[model samples]
Target chain A: SQQGEEDPQALSIQEGENATMNCSYKTSINNLQWYRQNSGRGLVHLILIRSNEREKHSGRLRVTLDTSKKSSSLLITASRAADTASYFCATPYVISYGKLTFGQGTILTVHP
Target chain B: EPEVTQTPSHQVTQMGQEVILRCVPISNHLYFYWYRQILGQKVEFLVSFYNNEISEKSEIFDDQFSVERPDGSNFTLKIRSTKLEDSAMYFCASRGRLRDSYEQYFGPGTRLTVT
Candidate 1:
C-alpha cells in the first residue's frame, strides 16, 4: 500500500509565485525525501529530511518534516514555468531496508 | 553526472509472453531498485537488490516477478508471463555506497504495453 499521500491533487500558479505541497504518511521513517517527475518519465531527487530534522533547503526548494504528525511539506519559492511537474514525497518503510513508499503526488503548473 | 539508464525505451508484448527489462546503473553504485507506474497512477516500488540478492520487495512483486543483476553494472527485471494489467512504465534506480546518502538516481522508464 502507498504510505504517503500528497495533498492538493493539482495546483496552478503564476511564475514568481510560491507553490506548496503537503504529504502525510502512516508509519515511522528514517527519513523523508521529495522527488519531481516530468511527464511520468523519471523521478528527480529533490531534498531529503531525516527524522531528526525539522527543515531543510536546497536552492529555492524548502522542505519541512514533522515526524510527530507524520507529515512533510515542500515549498518552491519564486516558481518558474520550468517548475511545472508532478512532485512526490517518499519514505522508507520502517523495517524494510532501501524500499521506499511513494505518495500519490501533486501536479503543479506554473504559468509564465 | 553519471545516471542510471534503461534500454528499449518502450516494449510492446502479448499477454502470457515473457519480458525482461534491463538497466545499467551508475558504475560506482551498489544498490539497485525497480519501480513501476501505471497510467495516471503513482509510482510503486517493486523490489530492491543489493549484494547480488533481493533485499526487499512489495506485495506487488509476486512469484511471477524476478530481479537479477546479470553482471556488475547491469540489473534486470523479468516477468514470467505478461498480463494486460502489467502494462505500465518500469523504472530502474540506483544509489551509491551506503555511506554516501539515501539519494537514488532513476533512469528514464521503459513503457511496457501488454496486449
Candidate 2:
C-alpha cells in the first residue's frame, strides 16, 4: 500500500506556538499534499509538494518533502485556536487517476 | 469559489436496503470521485469518474457499488445492499480538467448510519 503514516498521532499546543507533523510513505509518489479537516467537516487543501520539490509554503503553512527518505512534514507557524483540526498527508499515484491515498492524520488542538 | 455539494447530510437506513448518495461537483471540474471514512479510520478511495464513465476504482468498489452521472450536473453512488460495516461518512470530490491541477475539492460529506 502507498498509504502514508503520520507520527505523533495527536498534538496539543497553545496559541502563537508552532506545530509540526510528519508523514512517511512506502512507495514513490508524484506529489504529496496536506489537508486540514475540522471535526465532522470537509477537508480543506493546504499545500502540495511535488517529488522534485523539497519544500513549499502557503501562508502560515510550510510543507517539506524528501523523496530520498519518502517522508514529508507540515509546519504551521504561530498557530491560533482556530487552527485546531486534523492534519492529513495524502499522496496521489500517477496511475490512480489522481485518487489520493491518505494517512491516519494528526489531531491538533490549539488552546487559547 | 465552487465546491462539491452532497445531499442528506445524515442518513439512517436499515441494512440490506439500497441507498443512493448524490453529489453535484464543481461546475467546471471534469473529474469526480467518491471516498469514505469510518469513524476514527483513514479515508479510503472508492471510485473515480471522468468523461461520464468510471476511470478507475479501488478494490473496495465492488459489484455492490456503482456510480453514474445521471445528468449534466449530478453524480450519484448507489449501493446495492448496505451492511452494517458500510456505515461511514461518504465524501464527494472533484478537480479541474487542467493536466497539472491535481487538487481535489471535497464536499462536507454525508454520514450514513446503517442499522
Candidate 3:
C-alpha cells in the first residue's frame, strides 16, 4: 500500500496563478520530498522538508510539513507553462519501505 | 551533476520471459532502489538495496522480483517471469551514504511493454 495520498488528483490553472497540492501520509517519516515528472519520463526532485521543519522553499516552490497532521502541501507560485506535469509527494521510509513511497500524484496543467 | 543512469530506454518482451533492468547509480552512492509506474499511475517502490543485499521491498514485490548489485556501480532488477501486468516504466535511484543525507537521485525510466 502507498504511504501517502494526495488530494485533488488533477488541477488546471493559468500560467501566472498559484497551484497548490496536498499530501497526507499514514506513518512516521524521515522526510517528505516533492518531485515533478514531465510526461512520466523522469522525476525531478524539487524540495525536501524534514519532519522537524514546518516549511521550506526553493525558487518559486514552497513546501509545508505538519507532522502533527502527517500531511504536507506544495505550492507553486507564479507558475509557468513549463511547470505543467505530474507532481508527486514521496515519503522516505524508515522501516519496511526504505526507498521512497510515492503518492498517486496530481496532474497539473498550466495553461498560457 | 551526478545522476542515475538506466539502460535500454525501452524494451518489449513476451509474457513468461525473464527481464533484467539495468542501472548505474551515482559513483559514491551506497543506497539503490528500483520503482515502476504503470500507465497513468504513480510510481511504486519495488525494492531497495544496501550493503549488497535487499534492505527493503514493497508488497508489490513478490517471488518474481529480485534485485542485485552485479558490480560496484551497477544495480539490476530481475523479474523471473514477467506477466502482462509487469509492463510499466522502471526507474532506478540512488543516494550517497547515510552520513551524506540520503537524498535520492532518480534515473530516466525504462519503459517495458509485454506483448
Ranking by DockQ: 2, 1, 3
Range of the 10 consecutive residues with the lowest summed lDDT in candidate 2 chain A: A1-10
Selected candidate, larger DockQ, 1 vs 2: 2
> Which residues of candidate 1, in runs, are more than 4 Å off?
none
lDDT of every predicted structure (CA atoms):
0.91, 0.93, 0.88
Residues B46-112 of candidate 1 have per-residue lDDT tens digits of 9999889999898999999999998787899999999999999999999888743788889999999
Would candidate 3 be rated incorrect, acceptable, medium or high by CAPRI criteria? Answer: medium
Please state the CAPRI-style docking class of candidate 1.
medium
Best to worst by TM-score, what's the order? 2, 1, 3
The per-candidate count of clashes, in order, stands at: 0, 0, 0
- Which of candidates 1 and 3 reaches a greater lDDT? 1
lDDT of 2 by residue, A8-93 (tens): 89999999999999999988888998999999988988888998999898999989998899999999999999999999999998
Q: What's the TM-score of every candidate structure?
A: 0.97, 0.98, 0.94
